[model samples]
Target: MQPLLIYNTLSHQKELFKPLTPDHVGMYVCGPTVYGDGHLGHARPAITFDVVFRYLRHIGYKVRYVRNITDVGHLEHDADEGEDKIAKKARLEQLEPMEVAQYYTNRYHAAMDALNVLRPSIEPHASGHILEQIELVQKIIDAGYAYVSNGSVYFDVRKYQEDTKKYGCLSGRVIDEMLSTTRELDGQEEKHFSGDFALWKKAAPEHIMRWNSPWSVGFPGWHTECTAMGTKYLGETFDIHGGGMDLMFPHHESEIAQQTAVCGHGPCKYWMHNNMITINGQKMGKSLGNFITLDEFFTGKHELLDQAYTPMTIRFFILQAHYRSTVDFSNEALIAAEKGYARLMQAYKTLGRLQPSKTSSVDVKEYRQKCYDAMNDDFNTPIVISHLFDMAKVINTVNDKKATLTQADIDELKGVMDTFVFEIMGLRDEASSDNTALIDGLMKMILDIRATAKANKDWATSDKIRDELGTLGVTVKDGKDGATYEL
Candidate 1:
């Protein structure tokens, strides 16, 4: 099998993964801001990195995955002068700031859990770590990389650029380019340069989430919490730092500068970014008003959707494409994915019932190696699914007695399916239930009646039983070997 090769944003190339420690790996992903319900945009990184977390553990690494929840310090997209995002939402809804965060955080987890995403090992909240944020700001100030103005602290971009010589490497941005491209904002008189960002913002009297710090009664900057919380949990240097590609600039770039200025070294060994989900070839962002919330998609509440899609269908749609490629959403595409997902899942169910023969007809070992190779190649899930489809074809042929499988081959095939489908891909058989015994007994009784009808050449009775069961959400398929039913 090929060694895992992940595309590193810092190096701008796909490099072989070598952990800093032999058996341990630390990964930090920038998580939700919790100001609103999670949209389709949020699912990308959660599902993408969940696979990374799963694969790393599957390959024998003890992984620590830290995904933070940002309950504070986010500003409106256009107006840095505007109110905190969560605070603004709370005022509109007449609720406390923490109340808003808790409500949406619960909703976000429910959506992700429905999609079968693995929960992160450590999910830290920004509001819970104000002291650590203040200490980090003080460290930057003590290092002469930040200065105070009217009880507010701002990182000195010019000073850090002069000291480090490369400030915007992750964003592929030059200092001159930022000075030229960045729009002038209203309350930036305190900043010495256009590229300088806030380490702490002095809160207005009306601000409800203010905390007292050495700077003033203020809130930490949007970028400061990630640097502080990430370092606090994962140490100064870790294995992989991941987020959406949109965060590659400004947010992640600022994070690198802050960490480097304080620790005299960069934060992580590898940087990974998942590409955006698009609509009509444009990025789907909250500010753009083009995004559909996960709830909206599942409930068919969006004007653009034709009908609701199950969580497994959404997961299958995402895994059908490479993580690095932008996946465009459409009703047609979703319908296709839904059908394809059902076919694969049905085959997975059929594999268990196949009888083993003395002689093997399929090369199961080679097929298993291909599955591993696809995953090792930058976690290529699309290709892995293609391999699964091939396996499905073989399983179907063998079920028809056109092919054969030895006992060892049967065991290896089952292991491969379980690893790729359940463990690495993070997909579940959503149709499964604990009431299988009851459902199976009922279906058997109905099938017995149908068998009697068929034996008596009463086609009308047999067809009625099949049609009625189909309307009740159970599919009955008849073949020469036997009749099977699935719900």
Candidate 2:
């Protein structure tokens, strides 16, 4: 019943989401650099923006979500001085830079696909758009917002600050304060100020990924590709721009300045940032050596893991918190999430087998609104998940004959589950019942043999079957209704 309210990183407040166009929405999310294997840190933004993409479409907006892949021009230390992350990796592995990029990009895509993150409408690669980046660099130069120094192009932050006081707005940074406290940049002699950032970096002779640009034989700056590619795909001004909260300053901030400097206005109507994921109250990152890769989580290869977690369990764990809130990782927390997810999923399957009563006992209609309300409240997925659990309880009560459901209520409940569980939450049944069909059929025949044993008063054979299954952690429940088993 309420409109979606998005927290704008620009304004630092929650505002109603009104698309620029009546029926279409354009959104740009900063994607992976793909210099290494995808980690749990990488899963957050992909899943976060993925829910946004899905929810927008579910609400009937024709959405074009452009998420760019930084296949080139990303430095090792998040600074202009260091070698490209991909290039550095390539050097260590004795491979071409493009080869390294392609390998990791494939790995990233596979990880994302496992997480059920829908592919964006346009996934532009920086290496594929060197011309557009160069053109944008030249535009900034002509606009007097950038200057050529020592064969490299640097943004004139001091000069640009004088024209428009827009640089510090997104990051809440003061230009003078930044200059006073800023650390030494890579090309200190060439830059007018320490705060100045590279638009294009002049490559050294040893560098292998150099391209001929107006400035020098070099690659585009780390920040240049987003401005160029975002504008190229999503237009100079679009509806929303999103990424991790880590990109707020410098990355997203520079994006604003570049877009405003060249295009004369801000890039997007809303700036959304999802918060980080932490491990043991500390940030998870490759540099920190505390980070766990998604592969490690799925395979339980890391020493910190208790057991392997399915992709859906990981998804449920992330969505258990609000997007703006930081999610902490722990084996205990994850185990609880896994069990909770399994319970909810099992209830969903049970919903199909329920026999409707003559009268309805639960308010299924109210659930749809509550789930939507939770999601509409800045995409508060935790509350939506709680409501789903409530539905699960209802399903259990109905099955127990403690409550009742009409046929219409049954269908409505199923709709609510499908919408909140599958559609909005972007969750799928990870362990499909059909996936274990053959095993289920085998188990059924075995249990039928045990049943025959019981009918024949063969206590030894029944006990043998039960004890053998118990050793394998398979649980068999006997009741007057029927016999059931699970593994």
Candidate 3:
């Protein structure tokens, strides 16, 4: 099998993967803030890194994946002037902050589960690790990289830059460029430098979620939580850290600064960033107002969607595009993906029922190797899926008696489908999961009776069974293999 090569955002190039420990891999991904329902924007990262997690494990690596829930420390906006996202939601709903967090967190998990995303090994919450965050802030201050002004603590970017040479390495922005691009904040006198961000902000009189720290009763900075949580779980340096490409600046950059300030080294060996999902050629973001929620997509309740798309359809649609590419959402694109996914899945089901021949006519082993080659190259799921469709053509040919497959060839084909279609792609038979067995069994029995009626030239009884069964959410069809029924 070809070795896996992943694009590293830090190096700005695709590099061959080699775990820090021999066969062990550690990955950290920034998860949701739990302030509201998960939107389509949230699904990209969840599914993108989910593939990474699955593929790593598939390659015989013992992987430890840490994705955190930001129950605290996420300000409503980039500016420090807004209310806490969770706290504001709590007040509006007349619930505690934790209550709001729990509700949204469960909602997020349900959405992910529906998408078939595996839960992370450790899902640390920022609110639950106050002491660790406080200690980190203290370490930064003690190291002279941060200072407390009034009751708030801010990272001294000037001092940090003077001490550390590659301050803006991840963002590729110079301090002067940031100073020029960033809009001036109203209350900026406390910060020593224009780019310096809050390590802790002093809580207002009506602030809902405040915690006692060395500086004052304030919450941790947005970037500090990931650093503390990541280091706590994955150690000072781990294998990979992944998030949306939008987080490269400020969020991931600040994480690099904070981790280096305390631990004297960067947190992760590789940084992977998945590109955004676009709608109408524009990036789908919360601030853009073009964002659609996952619920809206699943229900087809959005104005832009033509019809409801099943969870598997959405997953297949996403996998159709390379994760690094910006996939534009449209009815046409989704329809195409839906039909393509159905074709592949139908062919997969047909593979099991195909009769084996004494002689093989195709090179099944070579085709299987090609599938692995596609996946090994940066987990190119789209290319791998395309190859699966090609194999599907072969399977269909064999099933139609236009070609042939030996017993060994049939076993190889089954193994290929099982590995790539189910194991690596993480797709399950969605139609088979919901009362399909019982429905299929009952339909088969009914179809048998209908076949006997047809054999006896009893047109009335056969048509009655077919028409009644069709009315009751089942369709019976007469085929070469007797009759088959479906709902």
Give residue 20's lDDT in candidate 3 (0 to 100): 93
lDDT (0-100) at residue 423 of candidate 3? 82
User: Global lDDT for candidate 3?
Assistant: 0.86
CA shift of 283, model 3, Å: 2.4
**Clash numbers, per candidate:** 0, 0, 0
Off by over 4 Å in 3: 285-289, 436-487
lDDT of 3 at 434: 71
Q: What overall lDDT goes with each candidate model?
A: 0.89, 0.88, 0.86
Give lDDT tens digits, candidate 2, residues 183-224: 765668888888888898898776888899867999888888
Give the Å error, residue 16, model 3.
1.7
Which pairs of residues have clashing backbones in candidate 1? none
RMSD per candidate (Å) reads 10.1, 10.0, 9.5
Expressed as tens digits, the lDDT of each residue in 1-487 for candidate 3 is 7788888888888889998999999999999989889987788889989988988898799999999999984853447455777777788889999988998999999889989999999999999988998989999998889999878888888888888876788878889988898777754787788788888888877678999987788888888899999999999999999998888888898899998888888899899888888887887776777778888888998887889887788888888888888888888888888898888888888988989889999888887788778877877899999889889999999999999999899889889988888888878778778786786677778788888899999999999998998888577777787887765
